[model samples]
Target chain A: MSDPCIICVAITGSVPTKADNPAVPVTVEEQIESVHESFEAGATIAHCHVRDDEGRPTSDPERFARLKEGIEKHCPGMIIQFSTGGRSGAGKARGGMLPLRPDMASLSVGSNNFPTRVYENPPDLVDWLAAEMIRHDVKPEIEAFDLSHIFQAAAMVEDGRLKRPLHVQFVMGVKNAMPVDREVFDFYVRTLRRLMPDATWCGAGIGRHQRTLNEWSIAAGGHTRT
Target chain B: MSDPCIICVAITGSVPTKADNPAVPVTVEEQIESVHESFEAGATIAHCHVRDDEGRPTSDPERFARLKEGIEKHCPGMIIQFSTGGRSGAGKARGGMLPLRPDMASLSVGSNNFPTRVYENPPDLVDWLAAEMIRHDVKPEIEAFDLSHIFQAAAMVEDGRLKRPLHVQFVMGVKNAMPVDREVFDFYVRTLRRLMPDATWCGAGIGRHQRTLNEWSIAAGGHTRT
Candidate 1:
């Protein structure tokens, strides 16, 4: 039988808030409840981001510890993944929670233009984050914002900065970054497979393109994010 | 009859200096002489970057004006393209020479990592540079360090931020950025042709891979840089 499709649900992202969606969970209790709902809906992985007291994104390890504990207790057998995205924190603080050792973390391997600013993942920062993940035995979901990022990730693996059998996420439809295009999406898949045949990959699309990515990912026999 | 291949010579870049190579032109007179040599060798375009008295890269419009004047005087019928790269300056300073109205100006629509740091080209700065190029009637040669930059340039054209009939340069082999790969080179050509059929493109590889890019570009019927 073909490998079952893994549904990864991002319970709360760094960008969205209660204002954007009333159902966005802010507190640890709410986040646990949200993950439990997604768990019941057959999501095998919980992609998480923590919020501060004022509903702002932060790289606070304390809140992340509490959320991880809650998810572990409430959603049995579901993998927990923390976001090391630039929006949540700057520099080393982005990897502060890696010591807690979630099953996985998101890693951006290169810089690209975001909607408003440059989503900077400098070489040093990317090396530092990959080292932290390795030290804590965390698998990184390589976040490829553009095409070169895939090549960079493969280079990191070859150089021993990253490990074998990588998990990569092809992100698309951001305002100034890679937009959602079917041909490019197919090329991304082909390139990743060509570079690292053992790697597993997923597709993520921002805003309205999310459902479109889900359909494409499923049809292409890759994982999907919701 | 097939169109003759256009050879563009980057007379002096930001990183290299007399220390790295004694032949690198640092002064205005030396740069003009260098362009004259390339023009005699059948190069029709002179890609230029100016240096200060201390031999460091600068966005000084005065220096650019002198270089433009020298090239125009020495290499008749040659296209002069100024480098608006991030290494020479930051923010709006990168575009300070656009008003000098060189035949073409290099524009990077996205950001990527250089050897040691993030090559930051934020959105606002990109928009400002594009607008400045439009205001000065200077044609932009899109410097695509990564795949997304091609898409970004096409989007800018569709949105009227840039003029049509684009000239894009596929830059590879930069450390920490896009590396030289034949598969990627072919994809870059195919993607550009798909997105903008009227567009012309060239291949550029840093350091030792420059000759490789020249050969691949020639074989693929694209322009090349030296």
Candidate 2:
């Protein structure tokens, strides 16, 4: 009868456009406001991406600094989750955003098609981020779009880069990622459950799939951020 | 890789109205045509519901007789999946569909909510259907809309109505059912893995969730019928 546990809000995601919903923040002030709004709406974690001064998407660490400080100023103690999926093809610049490492940095486990481009998180790049996360003491959140990505991520763990009590996000129902049906969600979850037995995961899906995957998180007892 | 494991085509589902999409068949001829089209479009399984000679949903085994005859005439040897979820309710008439003894009859473990109705598949009805399916050698596709449904069906197994090699369907993102998200999918599969470790399951999602789930099915080595 009480409220469901673990609500995480994904703020300023890299892909969603202003046309999708006008409320998607594109500026430091908008980002700060959005984070606070999500927090007030019952979110404990805020997944973030940076935008240029012109309100365009950017991977610049300084923009992150302002957003981070702004959130701290307004919504203190809120968990900050930074996106490591810098501009699509600028794979080499991933390390550039590590300046304000914050509490968490997302690392896509494998490459897959996105609507406009491929979300390529190559093994070497994944390794680079894992090593860097360890170096900075930042928690790495494995952002998996499909089952193969989970398998690839597990290999990383077996190879010793990813560590215990692993934090994962099973992304579904995206055009270039995994499909967002319940069976697909169930298969991915079951496969991962067998592979990463004790690991903790949450769900993030695009558009309508988000709500569906969100429900899966609620019923499965997985970590879910509103 | 090769074509996906199973191409399940859902035609003439009970709740979706013709107004939702004109493609939804209303007449028996229209419904049969949809099923044949799904089969021709590379689907191996056709999840079906027989419409009245009028547009309303009906549970008459005679109505299904025409459906069966049409499929055999149009696309022979295709798997036919029937619904125990008759449009009205799960009464003796609904439970009575088993006289036809379909190759596969949907066995919803418990009940949940729909937009305007309560789908009640109480334990007594479930027990009756389980026994019938076993005696007739029919496959009971235990369709679960929530986590509790999964357990409710499991209780049948403990009570000896449902035997090994269970076939479950995790129905996702339906209102008053289990929510559609990755965690719920995982929890259902994981729990089922521990309970009916040897069984097979498919995920059926409404609308946009389908494409996303197909990818998960491929990775998990589970069947994916679109």
Candidate 3:
């Protein structure tokens, strides 16, 4: 009945800006300081996204490298997970930061709807991103926006594209994507365990339900993203 | 227990050609003939897609008009459902034929991964399509490729974007989309019932699983497409 909870902090997602919340970190130095504070406060993992000089999301490998260096210097042993999310970039550019070889990178294996547009993770792009992660020896945190994505990850694992003992995160409460529901969360955990017995999983709830998912995941003996 | 199954025949989908199967209909006359034959064979609904002169898929309104006229004249009382699927056109072009006021039109309320690319049904596009469907009084066969889509349709119904008593089709067995699974199929039915008690549903299996979904739908008191 005991499990160690791994708290992953997504300091700055692709969305949300200073206008939305002034505390949102947008620069590499600010991100490092914010991540160090999170690490000191008990977050073991830093889920990161890079922004350009103008504070727009970008997949610049150099920016990623600088962020990684800053985090490693300030918060030693803290897990750094770069975001390869679609909003930051498109096609191969999304994986451009993989060469920096962070501890982990967020990967979406299937496409689903976002708030206003389609989160386009086509098969070829998915395969390519996975291959890049493997080549760079960077672990992937599978983002399961829908039920099929869990199965897609399993299929990729079985097909030798992804390694076993998978790490998946079930995200909910997006506008056009899966909403926060207790039954769906329970089903997701059950299905993940049934499909990949050795796999580890987590839960992420967007907006106001974030803490709700954190509690649910921790109580269910899974990790959590904050 | 008193459910009467509505059999739908997709005479010519966006994919497949005379080259793949010489019997595959391409021209307007061929499509009408094929649909008429299907109507005679017990199909109540004709799911249609028009092809160009060289056999490529097109969203040409003139061709759709001709096809509609032929189906109406040849098989009275048969339901004509045009495919507003992504392959035939992009953006508003996909809904151009909705003004023809066919009995129904296939509508994808959410996006998912197709075989080679993202089947992008963006929110704006989905909203626009639904608006057009409402304007033309054409019933939408909500294409539920994944579980969340059912919830999306339910939300749309609640918000008045889509009418009540939804018509959803669970599509399975595409390469990157949802695969054919009995557990998933059952879950879809149960979830649909739980979400929208009065709503009706259908099932469609691509390629090899066509008959399997048909059997499942018929056995479960739902409609089916071939």
lDDT of 1 at A74: 88
Q: Which has the better lDDT: candidate 1, or candidate 2?
A: 1
Model 2, B90-201: lDDT tens digits are 4667656666766788887654444344455555666677887888777888887655556556667877888877878887655423445676566667777876777788
Regions of candidate 1 where Cα sits further than 4 Å from its true position: none
Reported per model, the fraction of native interface contacts reproduced equals 0.86, 0.00, 0.78
| Candidates by lDDT, descending order | 1, 3, 2
TM-scores of chain A across candidates: 0.98, 0.91, 0.98
For residues A1-226, write the lDDT of model 1, one tens digit per residue.
1768999998788988888888889887899999999999999999999999888899999999999999899889999999999999899999999999999999999999999999999899999999999999999999999999999999999999999899999999998899999988999999999999999999999979999999999999899888
**Runs off by more than 4 Å, candidate 2:** A1-4, A17-20, A86-89, B1-226
| Candidate 1 vs 2: which has more TM-score | 1
Q: What is the lDDT of residue A189 in candidate 1?
A: 95
**DockQ of candidate 1 against the true complex:** 0.90
Per-residue C-alpha lDDT of model 3 across residues B1-226, encoded as one tens digit per residue: 3768899998888999889999898999999999999899999999999999989999999999999999999999999999999999999999999999999999999999988999999999999999999999999999999989998999999999999778899999998888898888998998999999988888999988999999999999999886
Over A66-168, each residue of candidate 3 has an lDDT whose tens digit, in order, gives 9999999989999999999999998999999899999999999999999988999989999999999999999999999998998899999999999887889
Per-residue C-alpha lDDT of model 1 across residues B1-226, encoded as one tens digit per residue: 1557889999888988899899999998999999999999999999999999989999999999999998888888999999999989999999999999999999999999999999999999999999999999999999999999999999999999999999999999998899999989998999998999988989999989999999999999889888
Q: For model 3 chain B, where is the 10-residue window of minimal lDDT? A: B1-10
